[model samples]
Target: MNTPQLTESIKSLVDNIDREYILLPEFQRDFVWEIRKTCDLFDSLVRNIFIGSIIYGKPTFEITVREIDRRPRKGEGSRRKLKVISLEKNEINHKLQISNFRLILDGQQRVTSIYRALKGIDEIWYVAKNEDELSDEIKSKELRDRTLEEMLYEFSLQEDPDRLSIKLADAFEISKGIIPDDIREQYFEKLSFIAGMDEAEIKENFKRYYTICIKLGELFNSEVLISYYLLNMDNEKFALFFERSNSKGIQLNFIDILAAKLYKGFNLRDKIDELKDKYHPNNLDREIIVRTIAYLVSDGKDIDRNYILTNLNYNHFNRYWDEVCELYNKVLNFLFNENFIISQSWMPYENMVIPLIIYLRESEQKDFSQMTEWQYEFIKYWYWATIFSQRYSSGSNEAIIQDANVLKSITKGEKITDRVFFSRLKSQIDSYEDIYSYSKKVNVIYKGILNLINYDAKGLSDWNNSSKLTPDKKLEDHHIFPKDYIKQQFKNDDQALSLMDCVANRTLIPKITNIKVGKKPPSQYLTELKNSNSKLDITLKEHLIPNEIIEGLYDEFFTDFLEERSKLLFELIKRNVIDKEKSIIKEYYQAPKVKGNIKIFATYYSKKVEATFDIESQKILFLGESHSVPSATNKAKFYLTGRNNTSTNGWRFWKFIDENGEEKYIDELRKLSRK
Candidate 1:
């Protein structure tokens, strides 16, 4: 067998890592070393022990690379003037320069541990003992000393000494060929004494201690601790080598998995940076892209971690990637223009964007600007209802995937047969009747309510100030009733503290206005507003604050204000979001003019079934419950035939009497009213 060779020194490896010179690939998992592991690794290094080799791949072609997380990463100014290189097969931009940088393919933990220790950036104060210089008396004394920490049991230092053992970082400074004066002198003087030095013993210990540090420097500077054989293969073979060496070593992240699996095969990071570069400061979370891709591969299944990683084929990532990026921005841009959530922080559930983007990809409404009012309304309804209902709060992966399916059906013009979805949504949204119960601190739901109230925010302006809320203006979630007022009125009542903070009494006021209105009673602000402007009504209406609710704020009935404002906001949501749910059908037809409830019937396979067409709501009523024609038909079919069918054509299933008293299929009404 060939002998194993070690060439790279620990100091060389640490010195080689700049963000660019030694590249940590975007595919590598984050630094996961505990402080103990860091201490142990450095302990081994200072002891002249083998700390393992770190493999580096010098790619011959342009590839994605990321900076060390602790170092100044991509946006923190380690960014080069380099354009993102396309790594898709047959699509490599040959004109782009392929920079020479070594990608660390293995032993990231050991490398990062030693690097952080020497740089003095890590948390653990790594203290090492020169075991060769220590005598049994010092060791025994250190062990039994009450004041000495157990960390450096070999060092019999003075009581309550800040440093127990010699600092490894100071010795590392001496390891360099160009030693700083402060470092060398400080290190040598510290080694002059192990503990309290008497004049008699100090001279004898000096040579032993100096030799101790000299030996430590020699060991640290030795070019034998870290060594690597360069991976000089072409891109294809190197990625394979990377997989074999590193894939299972760290806890796997799906983003890193795709970046690794799709290395040079597709350039996952390039596409991500493309989207981010376009959005410019609206940095989309990478997992959103992963989830969208997972949904593409999943084909209407549960979108959990196992399902995603197991089923993700980089081949399937080919066509859908560009479109997902485009449509995701479309949703974001719409939210921006509508004044709902201009930035990601305003979004309550970051994961909610996944189902929404997936829905847009599957939905027929591609352009938000061109959408018909009803099409736009459906999007708003889904968006607001999902938020107010906390639809993605628990079992979020399944919930989001299921909602994507429901949205997919709507896009396909298939009836929304999800009774469970809508019923749960309505129930949850209704429970917000007492808005105090659903939230804790400033959680997703709290942010969601702020986004919801932006429904009529076009005319939203500051109170007692004529300056309107523009795109660039900063905002504060101003308290409607001043905190001091609420506290004084209900000083002992604990509920007032939270109620005053709830969304019902909160609106996005200009930050400047909030600063001015600080601690001022609403009565004071209301009088100031009443004196300055006659258009106060317009501003109040714009914020969805009912005029009566404003009166409660003015009179200092803080509890009454929260209660009434909560009801008013809930009612507003009902009108703008909840009641608008069924308006999705307005895309295909005008509401049918069947007076009252029309009874309809359908039968198959010796089984006859009856259903009611509620003329008022324009939805089918089966067994006294309201459902779409498809839902009612499916239920009736399951009742008669025991077969669960999701794809039944609702319009062709039932017969109803028209105003002409002619028995006709409900399909006729669809035909007559088709837009």
Candidate 2:
């Protein structure tokens, strides 16, 4: 139950103890460290030692002691009973036992190095060879002539006499001959001085610290036990303590923790090894991939150190394992099939959050296929656009996030479709005809498009537009139509020279190269292509022109050449537009709904009647005078009465029908009025 400080002497004595007693179960994570990082740690240690700084704060080592029935390893055939000690400390512990204990952690590189160095195990040490040593035989051969031991001995005697001399001398007589006199004398002095020392002096001066062994009267059993208690009590507290106490300043990257968590779950370390061996021989750095994943998932949020740690512990492993596997496979597939090169020129923007939206939309819509020339053009334009925009150029994580959100919205079927967005972009380009004006607008549009692509254009622009490029040189605005040829042969005027400065006539080239190509027609370059053995010329011939020409052909030659190159550039811009449109449409909008009824109805009304007119009395009152005038009054009256009766008896029937088929009766009592 108690913890104790294990000193150098006790640690050495405990080296004889069983290693198994301290090792954790298979559930414990694998040891992970890269060569570069390990080298850095050693460098730091050396620096601290030389600078006379304290290497250890609380303790130098930790030893965990546990009692359990011994069991055979997972795949072993024999159920061999054995006792072991485990060195669980993060730092080096020279005192731990090699036999009964297992190195539960931090022992991979150390154990390998120690086993090779002390046990004299054969291991290759890749070192640079002198030009004389790298003869055709050695250069051409797949396997080396000498054993690793011999090579190591050679390296030691030749390069590192202080450590390797005694071992080399014992192993081979040739080493003694190679050892310099000064080195030989130093080695002899140390050996003789040690040999002459009494037992007490030897114990005081040359004793190894038993830093892992437990003492009887200390507060804790071992540093490992205390570490376990501290870590298990509160993980963050343990991390903070570890960060502070580990004065070597060996900071663990987020991916390291993520890798550890993954190893804890499914032995992912082995899986990673398999992936590396079969797919990427040089395993992608864990930090790079982790950063990429964070960028992909976070939508341009800044990934802080603590955030990285938290993600590595939980979110990263849970969210990205399958995605990582898929991406790796996709990348490998692309590489194997000779797909478009994932050039580093577009690394920042291409790998941003918005690009993830593009990828997801493309994947979902089944738009992505094997690389075609057009796809290459599209990618190139997108890359160029993003680079020009400088979206990734500033201290604006929020801007980046906002841009990603916009991209996501577009991809999710929002207001802007790819076509509209691209049309607007191209419009912006066409609006500015002058070269400088065009360049400035294009740069702005480029940034806008980059924002759509989920990249920080400002950031990228700043970096790319820095004065790091030689100021003695300006980016040459090459006249595809040779300027002198245009002026002298075409017009012999300033107007033609002005035309040569047009964007349509210009492309970027190194200023020095531009000066060299001055006044010469394409014919001269064509001739150089045909005559020169340089592969650069050959490449230029294929890329620049299809056929060789004579000097006088300049006027006709460059005209055609500029026209074609301009057309090609125009096509590239067009394709970029199409891709952007596609990205937008895929991210937004839904289909329309159906309806059943189509017909509609309206009502009709009859004209209003005149209320002043009397229907029955009017005829009689007006007829009074006429009746009196009529000589055959009796005959007239009888005729009138008969006519009125006949008219009244003969009523016609009419009906008004509505759209829905309901009918209404019409009045037959009144005369039809024209006025």
Candidate 3:
């Protein structure tokens, strides 16, 4: 193994960076080290800790690079650029050459961390008072330590060419007029220490000479170990190494790097922002849009790290950008119309939309109006089939590539029958027993069933039209045999409890009806519902509720009810989704009830609150009322506040009495569910 060079001083590295001799690679993850962590890094530097080495790749050709932001923020809009010196003036159109940049394979966090602390920007700096105080590790390394003496410095960016700085008091506070009161106080404390020292003592011990030479010397002389790799102009090789290294350590993220490289000078970030404004998609959605464009432009090729690395530039995207955008928008519209709400929980595999968009783009014949009814049917069948079969759940890239090629052919007038498609989908499609074994709505397959039923089942609820089920319409997962009734019959049989929660025993009903019919046997609810609504028979038929089971709703027949319902559901889905042939898939449609059960809770919240959540629809009954997940206190807060918006700290605020007779946060339940 070749040993990395460790001779570069901080000044040398900074100089190389300014002169364009060192550049960050397009595939390197962004600088996201927190401010305090950056301060800890500085502490390590002063303590002479070996903070680890940086890895750099030397490419044969010029590559697009981004300078490390000396001032990093949680969001991109708040970031400010580091002022860099020109290595060479532009001889052409006079714009700086973003292409002639160095690839930083590792240690970007350390480098930027150093840069920000040295600048005294964003309050990411600390000054140790004495060896005694420094020995207190906790006090010495706190990122936001209020007690530490703050160091302020002035940088002459234009005049110094080298961008050198000197502390104002000791360094001389050039930013004194603008510095905040708290920050100024920090600096003042350090100044007082110097003021107390005699001139000779200050010069000899504190190293405060005519210039702030000590600070400058320590900063410039600090050594950063650099492990440099020289390679040919193959982005593919570089990307493989980058991905492997990142996978083993902190994930910097490749999307931004690729985005910057591909759309250099084209303002791709602005385009994404525009899309965000229009569609209100999360960060993942935006990334999917970019990936979709890449996949289609590459002519249905598998999107691997190697492919992404080489295709960093937009030369290919430039050709089909408009068409991809148009078709992608149409796909989102399709999702909206189909009641496929685009939230994290509702949508399954956003990448799956790419192939569908590709088909739509190609099938439109460039006019968006050339698709025929047959093509539409094929699209619908392919979409639902892909979802039901978990086509993109794993090995998604290979699956998408396979589907893309097949879809391309299908769009070109080649006929693909259910038998042929099912053959391709056979390995992925679970057995009839697997589908019937699903006892919870957590599975995406369950969500898919609900979506299909929403479109297929009509006139089943108070809304008067199931076919036009809007995302806003609150729907509840109603148990066919009420939980209490099931427990009364099965008593302590965990297997029965598990079976009762299975998808086979559930149906989507209006939220109000779910609460009103809670714990009541299906026989009683159906009979009463039928009497109250004249259209009950048609509604039941649309919802795939077997008439035979409803007629015989005794507690002893609960297992039989699930069996019949499961069969009916299998037939309904297979016929409508795969193909409309009878007896063709009977072999794959029968599910024998698997014995053995697990105890699942009602997992609910109360009904009285008129908040966004509905008690009946959410099925989360808490404190004797039915409230959705949002109203379930802790779990609901996490949802209502939007993920990561932990201003309310649901884990702290949302408490519940555990069965163990102890009060615990509801988020504990979520953690248990994950396990």
Candidate 4:
């Protein structure tokens, strides 16, 4: 169903394009070449050098298509945008005979260049022996603000320009022997001007003029430089061809392709630039914008890639674009107020907000500010439950839409059909063993903890300055026990060293305070801060740092401080987020299963509690005992924390080594297993 016709003449390609025997697909991005490339292309053709082969699809099925743009992509031409032709297949076939058309699947730039040159459409091509030097000189003049009128010889302009050469359009007409007496005289006048117009010289070079006409004419009608393959295709192969490549060799993402498809009514790239905000200053995520449009167009039923590709229409763009932006801003504002999202850096996933958009649209909330206390509380539950649960970790389109439906019911204050939130959301939150984990890891759960502390305290205050922390601008995930301090004290104890980075050991504070605090232990920094500032306790409260935790900063009590703060963090989530109790303190611990490992080792100073997991059995063999992961983790943690540990959620007391040979808390392994 194909032929590699190396013998396809330039004349045949041009003739077919002129008669509408060849077409371009509707989704093809308009010509992407500069005038220099066009000139280089002509230079290649005149010398009969091989350019890349163009592919033409002779499709028996009718596909949406548009004419090539009237102008080259770079040079000056028509300013109007293209329009789409959406018609029934039967009507398109009979009325336009699309099946008879050959679509240029590749080498669009090459074909378009030659077509423009032969037909003399977009820009004038010139015949000069030293065309490359002329092209370079013209480029120099362009950079110096000289107009094309001042640089090139336009016979219509009747001006003596700096660079004079034979215009191909005039030469083509003359070569066909179609010039009238006066027109032929005008051509000679331009040609003679290039030779400095001496009457004696004109008489001497008359035969050279005839030779130029014969040779250039043959060059214009020449064959064999461009090879083409004509493919007799069906719709499926045509689509596969486009997937690997479109008119260009590189594959564009769907959002880019959609922009081309909607070129008639919208300049999507320009529109998205207008939609930028602080959270996404460079540009908003294009896929989310497309997904929002897809959601609105399908009336909230579908937002998958294929559905949007085949179904998105222009009617909904204007209607939904502004509102989508508005709703997203409102959602961000709501999250910012609660400290769930302080800035772009604190955002867990951009797609996670899609559910909030669904809730806003479904509830028809005119202004999010007008929402009641119950609505705010509901959002907090959803936010905490999803983040702590790590639900939307990957491939979450269906989950987002599903949760959106559940949230819609919340707007109506209906029965919560998903009883897990009411009953076990706390347990789900409690299940992660790393609740006391530290090092200011920027996972949603870790950030969620920081948000919780900030929310409960109204805002995290600077320990040194006594001012509110503005994390949107500059915030640091400051460590209470500096990594240097821990490494110095426990240089040989891998288990002791492993506990330094637990989320419980870190706090969100202003960068200025962190810089002033430096690598000093909490005992040293807190004493220095307390001596200078009387209300250091108030700042400490904001960061979930208890006075006792700082009091025990000696080397012997490093584990003691970690144990206390981890318990405090565990209790804070349960009280503030899980319980909606308007606070950030509760002391508990629990551990979940490890990921990518059959065995996990929990470290406890000089000793260790090693365990192997059987996911199928859902059990852990602890040293000589067989127990559920939680029971085994609890026993090890309580024994490790050594008498200070209470009814902890438990996994915070344990540690494991990951595949990277790095020691981690069992809770980190739990996060991997969930993923």
Compose the digit string of candidate 3's lDDT tens values, residues 1-675: 235464678766656665655666655676655444554454445433345677776555434566666543322324234444323324212333443345578788887766555554444323333221123343233223322223222122111111122332223233223343443345333443333223333333233222233343544555534333455525544443343345456664456567668666456667767766765443336556666766765756647655765663676656655566667777766666654442234555577777767677667454335666666665666667777766664445666776775566567765432233344443222344555545446555766665566556532344233233344446667787788889887876655665777777777766777787767677777777777766666666766776754575555677677777667666657766556322233322222121122112312222112122221232354455554343344444334333331112222233444333333343344333332
**Per-residue CA lDDT of candidate 1, range 5-36, in tens?**
64776666667764345666667786655444
Spell out the clash pairs found in candidate 1: none
User: What lDDT does the true structure give each of the candidates?
Assistant: 0.59, 0.33, 0.51, 0.59
Summed over model 3, clashes come to 26
**RMSD from true fold, candidate 2:** 39.0
TM-score of each: 0.46, 0.28, 0.43, 0.47
Q: Model 1 Cα displacement at 229 (Å)? A: 32
**Better candidate by TM-score, 1 or 3:** 1
Which 10 residues in a row give candidate 1 its minimum summed lDDT? 154-163
Q: How many clashes (backbone N, Cα, C below 3 Å) per candidate?
A: 0, 56, 26, 18
Worst 10 residues of 3 by lDDT: 154-163
Lowest-sum lDDT 10-residue window in model 2: 208-217
RMSD of each predicted structure: 27.2, 39.0, 29.5, 32.3
Candidate 1 local accuracy as lDDT?
0.59
TM-score: model 4 vs. ground truth: 0.47
Clashes of 2: 56
**lDDT of candidate 4 over 1-675, digit per residue (tens):** 233565566667777776777778887776655444566565445533346668877554657777765553322233334545544567556644543456789878888876776666644445322111233334333222432222332222111222234666666677667544544476756553333323433442343344555566766566655533336533322333344344555765667767776777877877777777444642356677778778767756788756766777666676787778777777777667666765556666677778787778777555667666766666776677676655554325655766676566666654343222232234335533455433335455767677777777776677776777664557777778888877886677665575676677777766777788766766887888888778888788777777764565454577766766667777876765566622311111123324433776754434566777655554677767787655675567556544332222223334555433444444444343443
How big is the positional error of residue 606 in model 2, measured in Å on the Cα after superposition? 69
